[model samples]
Target: MARNLDIALLRTFATVADQGSMTRASDILHLTQGAISQQIARLEALVGTALLLRHPRGLRLTPAGERFLGRIRPLIITNDEIWSEIERGDVSGPVRLGLPFDLVDSCFAASLKSYCEAFPKVELTLVCAASPDLLDMVGRGHLDLAVIERAVDSEGGEVLAIDRLVWVGARAGQAHKRSPLPISLVGETCVFRPAVSEALAEEKLASRMVFETGGLDATRIIVKMDLAISAWLASTVPADFDIISEDAGLPPLPSFAITLHRANGARGAIFDELARQLRNAMARPRLAA
Candidate 1:
């Protein structure tokens, strides 16, 4: 008799590998922690070797596990795509998507790509703008779905994650310590601009707007060059910069409500599935550089 690999177990294993923690995998898969452990144990038993190593920090893939992942990841993705297409059953239409400019380099980029690959027939028109503008577009039915970062206590829309906003500056930069802090901002329409300004004012910290741009890449370059400090969601901050703290004399910024809004006319299975995929992708841990 020969042991057979289980698709369910493989799915759980891949999720754990992607998430780097059983707890996070459980959350993403909607399974109990014990259940995820059991699935991994069963998978290891099938292969007759350890697939994952438990460490103080988190889970790490064994050499065998890494090779196995490389082989099976494409298969799993293809299988899921097929299953999704079959489940949707002839659902095809255009989905107008609105993304904030800041999110283009975040997890949403990968998610959007995955969604497009899975449903190639669904015409996805994406527009990048500030959160306020995106929200307005979605509310007016200009976009089928919009992902926006709103103030933590703001109402309306399906909240996905509560993300912390932080002050960030170039690595080893002394710009943050300068009197009348030099700052870079998106624009007046940016949701973070007013909050960040108000926080600075409340702390009686004088600041100078040294740069302003709506492009995240340009802003990143300016920050990386130690030109000025700017505010960003902690998770979305580029790896090159250092997050400033109160000890650095920067006032604390409020958390943001990562919300998803759908137009009333766009309520359907396709919309729900897109939202589900987005949430799953966002829930995954940020990719390590």
Candidate 2:
């Protein structure tokens, strides 16, 4: 008879490898450091070799440990995915989720659709706005949880994707050729507004804000019509849009973190599960890259 590997032990090892610290892995797995150490030891004993080594930095995986983790990582991911699907029906509740307008179509369509289908009883409330507005809405009790984009170094929130900000123009758009640089603005409180302005100022590029709109559709129409150029997270750019190339003399934009924030005192299975879906969705692209 063949010996079976312990999936739980493998999972612990994988998590510790990703986090680089036994203490950090414990926090994520909700196990004490002693428990984490013991589990690692048990796994090493079963494998008949030391798998982890401690250096000044953190836990470094031995060659054997690296090979083990690589082999079992796929198994761990698939196991979790299967469990998520099976448990979906058991999860049903209202979950208020906020997102920037740009993310709804490009990144989250599949994940949100899966969520709605799996948790049929979940009353999902989706609010679309600028990142700052989403945070404000959550604070004012208008929302339960929000996925907001922030400067990469900003504190707080669970960072989902560290997204690249880029200048976007309509395909074959003449807006970039316009003198004084016709820049388009989204919402009044757009978080990217300042970033865009600062980038242009640093480059000493002459620019003018042309059309202002609270509606995303209207802004897209203006942009698609080749009237004004805009900025968007690289991942969220529309299929018909073009990222204004560096040769166009456009200043390089800063990267931002796609972050998740739950309301203060927020605690429930629904909140957690919904947030899990968001995390899973955002992690896919990053993992692929």
Which ranges of candidate 2 are over 4 A from the true structure?
Answer: 1-77, 286-289
lDDT of each: 0.80, 0.82
Alpha-carbon RMSD, each predicted model: 7.5, 4.5
Please give the distance, in angstroms, between residue 206's alpha carbon in candidate 2 and its true position after superposition: 1.8
Clash pairs detected, candidate 2 = none
For candidate 2, write residues 1-289 as lDDT tens digits.
9988888898889878765678767855679999999999999999999999998978899999989877887676667668778887777777788999888878787889987887898999899998999998889878898999999766656656678999888998889888899988787788899899999999899999887675677778889999999988898888788888989988899999887888875677677777767866775653111
**Which residue pairs in candidate 1 have backbone atoms (N, alpha carbon, C) closer than 3 angstroms, thus clashing?**
none
| Predicted model with the maximum TM-score | 2
lDDT of 1: 0.80
- Error at 91, model 2, angstroms: 1.5
* Per-model TM against the reference: 0.70, 0.78
Stretches of candidate 1 off by over 4 Å are 1-85
